[model samples]
Target chain A: MAIDAVIPFKPKNPKTRLSCVMEQEERETFARAMLADVIAASCEGGCSPRLLCTAPYLHPTAEVCVDADGLNESLNRVLSAASSPLLIIMGDLPLADGAAIRRLVSTEADMGIVPGRGGGTNAIFLRHPGRFRADYYGASFLKHMAIADEAGLSVEVIDSFRLHTDVDEKEDLVEVLIHGRGEARRCLQSLGFVLSVEGGRVGVERRTHKETL
Target chain B: MAIDAVIPFKPKNPKTRLSCVMEQEERETFARAMLADVIAASCEGGCSPRLLCTAPYLHPTAEVCVDADGLNESLNRVLSAASSPLLIIMGDLPLADGAAIRRLVSTEADMGIVPGRGGGTNAIFLRHPGRFRADYYGASFLKHMAIADEAGLSVEVIDSFRLHTDVDEKEDLVEVLIHGRGEARRCLQSLGFVLSVEGGRVGVERRTHKETL
Candidate 1:
């Protein structure tokens, strides 16, 4: 059976919550950089994923399949159209390496769900793509698990900290900087990113250097 | 009915998890600053209980009573010694203000349990201090709740994000830098702490200034 990968990319106004700390342009830039890293990791894991973008945009590293709908609908469309086994991965996991992806897809179960931090469904591999619909609502990992159980499909629970820690909050960026060595890290470094220690805890701080006249 | 706030502080090895990002001297300084802020907030809420420390150290603002023991034992000692109502508050809650403290102590229950983010007992207000002991181990919130239940005491669960977000990990520094505007923030600022954005998220970064010839 052929197995394909599907990555949902939201390039337009991505990481809006991060706008509390990053400007619009910077947020978009950082989001694309993370997407690039995710794409690279997926490719290295031996699965050329169909990049499903929310809006039409040029991905320098991967091909785009625009789906101008919400997350569940967009993902459902891709799964519905698929004729073989598929792996769905979120495009924000900066620490998603080849080994992690391989471990996730190498599961024996017909359906595998990777739980994210804070009750999110980070990645899922399905042998019957058309049979299962995507549900990305609150506490989605449990919901997806229930879905597989109700469907009477063998489900494997894939729990990896690196795969689970998807970049969502401002604090999450600290993890990326600490553990990540990819396009996202390079993008942050180019934008003058550095680690800051506050209240005996570590965080990220940006420094802009100006030429002295 | 006097409400006293007993803040358990470990100044020697405060926030050791943050050792991944902060130096020993820096951690000590920052921990003390956070403790000072917690003390000020507690005092403003009309509770000027003794600051319990594991080691003998002079606090610039709050009076320190050295316990020279571990957490549960030292706290039990203080609870046993106390004759009236006492509130135990952790020293690392940088976002804790007077209002949150007032809310916590104002509860009508005989025993109040304030929960931390990751299954920690952040603060507890005991109307009958001598009647109950504290269990501040892993997942101590549930243990404290069980203790209250077994004692047949009226338990009030005080849920406050400000009180819950303790400065335990590196990412926790983000909460302090974003929402905190007290001694802890000032201490970090004095040590060249600033905000940085990477991967569309916020973090704290330090920038040291050097003198040139």
Candidate 2:
């Protein structure tokens, strides 16, 4: 099935721990690369979801949402803009990659809603494919899930590591950096982050999936 | 405001993992110590609106559910067994401790539901006192939330690291052990269970909470 991947951009508070400390150049590089990774991962997983984008720097994305409306509006914009199956995402999310979206899209449910650990919808999909106005994604994930259930939509919350962690605070930056320490450890070294003994002692793990696509 | 903690016992697998690695005596010691930790911590937390009791160990918790019938049975047990506000807990949970329950019980809410990730409900409190018959546990957090909402009960999901990670698998074990590391690290440690990784390179920045208790 073809998908129109939607990323909603809601500005973050500078004081908000999740604000990006990376400069403009780094941010752009990260964004472009991240988008590319999502696209490539989707392709590898056999999902051909198109990108319906909205954010700080709109590139040659499928389309950039002009109004900086809140999350629901931005999500509805891209979801409404396309008639194809789609996965709506949080643009600020740096951890979610193609694999996560693939799993989410591949999930066999009438409506696939990826609820953030905190209250909010990280990524949502409509097997029916249309502009269904779901006014959620606020203070709570529980609230968001409740709204989905009331709409009579069949919802499934898939357990995916990448999908689970959305970079939202200063500490998130550290978490991701520490996770980078695989054979990719030098990547963190290059990025100028430190790995406390805590990082190694705590360790990291990812789940296995039945091959996607 | 008071807690009568109920631990529903349903063990999915044998205690082989904990028993196999450690000495037989050590395994028993570990279980007893763990139980003591829960009791002592609960006392220290000074939260339990009432009392904490364990259902006679019988079924695998995964088998014992919190659906309508199960919830009704548990609530009936709570009503008959407890004289104070009741907070329901699953006995299979090796990680949940007193500090977490205290936080759940002591926190002010007309009614409360401690949610587990991926549509599972951990613990719930009813202000009506000994009047709960809602079955919720395993994979039914959302259902219980709706039930509470329908009853016009104020429902809250308290943000506590100690409570969030439920041990259902090997990865969950890693996550449970890594709790109390703060929000960012807690989330990242969950990532580690799914894959092998190194020290640094990627960053998962969470907006740090001022963490007001």
Instruction: Specify the highest-TM-score model's number.
Output: 1
- lDDT (C-alpha, whole model) for all candidates: 0.78, 0.48
DockQ of 1: 0.02
DockQ of each: 0.02, 0.03
lDDT of 2 by residue, A1-213 (tens): 456565544322222332345554444444454454444545555555344333354455345545556556666565566666766665544445455577778888867766553434556777764535656533334555666677677777654435555555444444445322222233333445442234212222221232211
Candidate 1, residues A181-208, lDDT tens digits: the string is 7989888778777666555345677777
B9 Cα displacement, candidate 2 (Å): 15
Given candidate 2, what's the lDDT at residue B102?
A: 66
- Chain B: TM-scores of all predictions: 0.93, 0.59
Question: How does chain A of every candidate compare to the true chain A by TM-score?
Answer: 0.94, 0.68
Q: Which ranges of candidate 1 are over 4 A from the true structure? A: A211-213, B1-213
